[model samples]
Target: MRDKVVAFVPIKLNSQRLPHKNILPFGDHSLSWYIFKNLLNVAGIDEIYVFCSDEIIMNYIPEGVKFLQRDSYLDGDMVQGHEIYQSFVNLVDGDIYLLAHTTSPFLTSKSIENALLNMLSGKYDSALSVQQKQTFIWYDGKPLNYDSSNIPRTQDIMPIYMETSGFYMFKKEHLLTYGRRIGFNPYFQKLNDIEAIDIDTREDYEFALKILETNKQIPIC
Candidate 1:
């Protein structure tokens, strides 16, 4: 039998960088509206869990979506994403879990389904969105991917993949048993820079708007 795919979106009212960001107006829909709408369009997703605490944001949640009331303790500024996941593992059931966020406002449904397909393929126990940055890299004030004495073409440099946190999918047992989001072997799904942009600062939010306008393919789910 095939495994079921459940998506969990952890939301809170207080945002350190942008207060009430999850509910912030973005075009005709709020920040999370896009993700919610897109996920609804995804046939691969068995369920979409809107894990939230703020009632104000509930208004943004569309009809027929599953609402998971988050504990007030997990809504604090210091609470980590993994901490929230710990709370979810005790509640939800699925062979594969898709954990995403409103911060990734432009996360494409195609990407979401693709990630789910990758997870179901069993190539890796887990999968998440990432961006390929094939640029100059460095660490601890030392050249990381290139040599100071001998320079190589940009194409010759090994590309570095950065976790975009746009979306993630993992086997339910992988998380519940190991207490980690990903298993020993994980698949990194590469996403384009524009599609993988994460909303962290004010500028990032604005950038997402531009992307949304340029690409009309993103529909309201």
Candidate 2:
């Protein structure tokens, strides 16, 4: 039997960096609408739910998507992300879960489909979207992805895979057992810079809007 995939977008109405960013206007619909619509179009998603505490979010979402009323306490500023994940996984039943966020407005269905397909293939236990950047990276005041002694060109440096807040594909059981979205055996789904844009701050949101404005023909979802 094929595994059942349940995709969800967790929305918190009160955003600290950019207040009400999730419901902010993005093209014809709100910010969350893009990922919601994209998930709806993905072929293998058994169900799509908007896990949020606010019912007002209904107005922003498109039809055919169900809603789940989450506890408002999960929206607390001190709440750790894993707590919310655990809460949702315990509430919803599915063999696999596609965790997406409204901040990832440019996350395309193609990237989501590819990641879902890879997870279904059984070659890997989990998958998450990432962007490859070949730049000088420093951690703890030391070069992380390169050797300062060698001083190689940027292109010559090994590419660092940066995790994007776009989406995560993982087994439900694994999350329940390990309390992790990224399983031990995982696949990194590469996405272009534009497609991986996540709107966290005002600058990020403005940048995303600029991208859409620059290309009028670009698909909002």
Candidate 3:
């Protein structure tokens, strides 16, 4: 039998950068609702779990979505994403797990499908959505490069990739066995910066709203 694919969306209420951001409305619906709806539209997803601790955010959860009330131990600002992923691993029985965030509303079903397909191709133990970046990187007030004066064209340089906090896919057994989000090998699914935007501050929230208004169109859920 094929393993079922489950999506776990972890949302915490307390945010130092943007307080109560999960429940904040983007256009007409709460932020969490937008993500939850998108997950539901994906073709191969068997279950969608919304993990949250805030009552205000919980109250707005739409129908047809599973709600997992987060425990106090896992509801702190310092809690890592791996902790939340492990918590869901304990509660559910699925072969594949997809960890996503509520702050990124631009994640489309096509992107989700691509990530899953790439993970299934056997080239990687886990796959994550990332934004490929190319810029002069600095560390400790010093440039870290093989040739200090060689600032090649942005396109020529090897692009730096970052996990966009949009989505992650991994096998449940791999997570339980390794105690990590990814195993020995991980693959990256490159995404555009606009599609990878996550709300971390008031400025970011404003930017998301502006993007939504400017587009005047939300991708099909």
lDDT of 2 by residue, 60-171 (tens): 9999899999999999989988888888888989999999998987788988999899989999999999999999999898999988899998889989999997999888
Question: Which residue ranges in model 2 land beyond 4 Å of their true spot?
Answer: 217-221
Tens-place lDDT digits, model 3, residues 1-221: 66688988887777678888888887878787777787877777899888776555657667778877878678777888788888888988898898888888887877877878877777778888899877766779877542467778766776678889898888988888878777678888788766898888999999999999998966745
Tens digits of per-residue lDDT, candidate 1, 1-221, equal 78888888889888889887888888787888888888888778888888887666779867667888889899888887888997886788778888888888767888877777776777788888899988789999998888978988899888898999888887777777777787777788888877787998888888877887888545543
- Give per-candidate clash totals: 1, 0, 0
- Return the TM-score for each candidate structure: 0.92, 0.95, 0.90
For candidate 2, list the clashing residue pairs, or say none: none
lDDT of each: 0.81, 0.89, 0.80
Which consecutive 10 residues in model 1 have the weakest lDDT in total? 212-221
How does model 2 fare in lDDT?
0.89
Clashing pairs in 3: none
- Residue-level error in angstroms, candidate 3, position 112: 1.1
Of the candidates shown, which would achieve the greatest TM-score relative to the real structure? 2
Provide the global lDDT of candidate 3 against the true structure: 0.80
